[model samples]
Target chain A: DAGVTQSPTHLIKTRGQQVTLRCSPKSGHDTVSWYQQALGQGPQFIFQYYEEEERQRGNFPDRFSGHQFPNYSSELNVNALLLGDSALYLCASSQTGHYGEQYFGPGTRLTVT
Target chain B: DQQVKQNSPSLSVQEGRISILNCDYTNSMFDYFLWYKKYPAEGPTFLISISSIKDKNEDGRFTVFLNKSAKHLSLHIVPSQPGDSAVYFCAASEGGAYNTDKLIFGTGTRLQVFP
Candidate 1:
């Protein structure tokens, strides 16, 4: 089966602007989680959504938010983007409340100038 | 604080040899652990996993060993292949379901296998 997929494989934005990244969970998956991976650094969790509602969030600021639609697709919105926000934004999908595994998407590379 | 840790930033091994990647977690409550392998420009793919109750779990050329007392886990790749070269990530979760379990990940270790 096709795995998780994210749109706008790469994007360029300016500081003080807003950007939205999109993702579609893998087939048979319900929960979607967002992660930001800086260069040469491990991924840090942003937030998780299940049943169209956010369930868990990380230590990120309010400027980072997400939404899960009824189709199990999701969107990540960052307002007032900063140059530091430029990184690989990965989207992962797993079965809602699953104990098994999580599948990640190819990720959207956001570059802020 | 970073709950999961992979001290080795990179490792190199000759093909057909064994490769061991180490990971230590500070959270004692974590009961499940997993390893993901990622190639450049791609997302991480699940390699193997082991529950806290078990000491070892093997899948073909991959094996994961977990030590509850030490709060450590290691993945052993036997007879490594050139295609196995990638960044490996260690992750852990606890109390799955009930909105209690969230997978915490560590900084990845890059592995290079020379043919």
Candidate 2:
């Protein structure tokens, strides 16, 4: 079974531009969460979505937003990106009620110039 | 403030030896702890986890030990193999607290198993 999958393996954007990244949850999973990992640093939580509604969020700013579709797929959008936004964006999927042990997808590398 | 910390940035161990990676957390609210293995350019893969109620959990050659009193957790890999070399990260969740599934992660420790 394909675990979790993400689109646009790599992207390049200039400062002030916007970008969108996508993710498909694992089979039989209903929750999706996004994370940002800077070079040489561990992933920092972005937000989590369940039932097409945001359930939790991290310390990210308003420019970072996300959407969850009925199928449990997800999208992470960043507006007015800054050079500091360049990082690896990761998507993780988990079944609700499972104590939050998530399975992750190969992240998308975002390069903000 | 960093909630979780993996003080060792890197470690080198001989193959077939036991590799112990350590982690400590400052948050008492975390009730569940997990260990993940990550390769360069790839997302982390869940390895093992232990709840606050349990002190240890073992799977194959991987064993995770949690010391609640010390607010510390560790992953032990016996008979370490070359394939086991990777960056290992420690993650924690608050369980039902705040009714969210947010996880806080540590900076990670790189393990290199030499054959």
Candidate 3:
């Protein structure tokens, strides 16, 4: 079983440009969460989606938005990106209402120039 | 302020030795604690977790201990091997076995098991 899958292993974008990252949840899972990991730092929670609606969000700004489709897939979008936005974007999937470990994807490296 | 903290930036231990990684948190609301191992260029992998009601949880050679009063948690690896070398992160969640809670992660400690 494919645990979790993310698209665009790496990406390069200019400042002020928008970028989108995609993620497919693990089989039998419906919740998707996005995280950003900066250099020398741990993964920071961005937001979590369930039932195609955002259930919770972290301290990130509005520029960091996301969408959950009916297929249990997710998309993370960053608008007007800044150089500081460069980081590794990770996607994690878990079953709703279950106390289990989250399955993480390989992550997408975003470099904002 | 960092809600979760792994003070040790790196540690080196000989093979077949015990590797203990420690973590501390400032949030008392956190009830679920987890440890994750991460390799370079990959996402953090869930290692083990302990609920607030439990003081310790063990799986194979890995064990996690939690101290509710001190807000401290630790991961112990017995007879550490070379393959165990990786960055270890401590994460916490507020609602334990109740609802969906976002995970807060620490800076992480890099463990290197040498031969």
Candidate 4:
């Protein structure tokens, strides 16, 4: 079975630009969550999507948004990117009932120039 | 504010020894805790976890201990091997029925196992 997958292994974006990263959850999983890992730090929660609707969010600002398709794939969009936005964006998937464990993808590295 | 904290930024242990990585959280509502291991250029992989109901959970050579009163948790790896060297992160989430609860993570601790 295929695990969680993310597109565009690495990306470079200029300030004031916009970027969209994609994610495909693991097979048999329905929930998708996004996280941002800055240099030398652990990942911080961005938001989670279930049933094509956003269910939970973290302390991030409005510049960050996400979407989940019917097939359980997800997209994370960041607008007006800043240098601080440069980080590794990770995607995780898990079943709705099983809240404790989440399988993570290799993540997309976003470097804001 | 960082709800979860891993004070030790790095640790070095000799092979075949026990390695203990510690984590502390300030949120009392956090009942679920997890540990993840990550290599360079890779997403973190779940290592082990413990719920508030259990003080300890073990899986093979990996074990996790939870101290609810102190708001602390730890991951123990026995007979550490060189391959076990990686960055370890501690994450916690509040009680919730769905999988939407956001996880608070620590800064991370790097473990270097020497042969």
Over A1-113, each residue of candidate 2 has an lDDT whose tens digit, in order, gives 98999999999999999999999999989999999999988899999999999998999999999999999999999999999999999999988875546999999999999
Best by DockQ: 3
Instruction: Sort by lDDT, best first.
Output: 3, 2, 4, 1
Alpha-carbon shift of residue A113 in model 4 (angstroms): 0.9
CAPRI classification of candidate 3: medium
Q: Which portions of model 2 miss their true places by more than 4 Å?
A: B96-100
Model 3 residue B66 distance off true place after TM-score fit, in angstroms: 0.7
Report model 2's chain A TM-score. 0.97
| lDDT of each residue in A1-113, candidate 4, tens digit only | 99899999999999999999999999999999999999999999999999999998988999999999999999999999999999999999989876558889999999988
Candidate 3 has an interface RMSD (Å) of: 1.7
lDDT of each: 0.91, 0.93, 0.94, 0.92
State the fnat of model 3: 0.66
Measured by lDDT, the strongest candidate is 3
User: Per-residue lDDT for A1-113 in model 3, tens only?
Assistant: 98899999999999999999999999999999999999999999999999999999999999999999999999999999999999999999999878788889999999999
lDDT of 1 by residue, A36-60 (tens): 9999877888999999999999889
Task: Summarize candidate 3's per-residue lDDT along B28-110 as a digit string, tens digits.
Answer: 99999999999997888989999999999999999999999999999999989999999999999987864357899999999
TM-score of 3: 0.98
Instruction: lDDT winner between 2 and 3, please give it.
Output: 3
lDDT of 2 by residue, B1-115 (tens): 9999999999999999999999999999999888999998788999988888899999999999999999999999998999999999999988742224778999999999999
DockQ of 2: 0.54
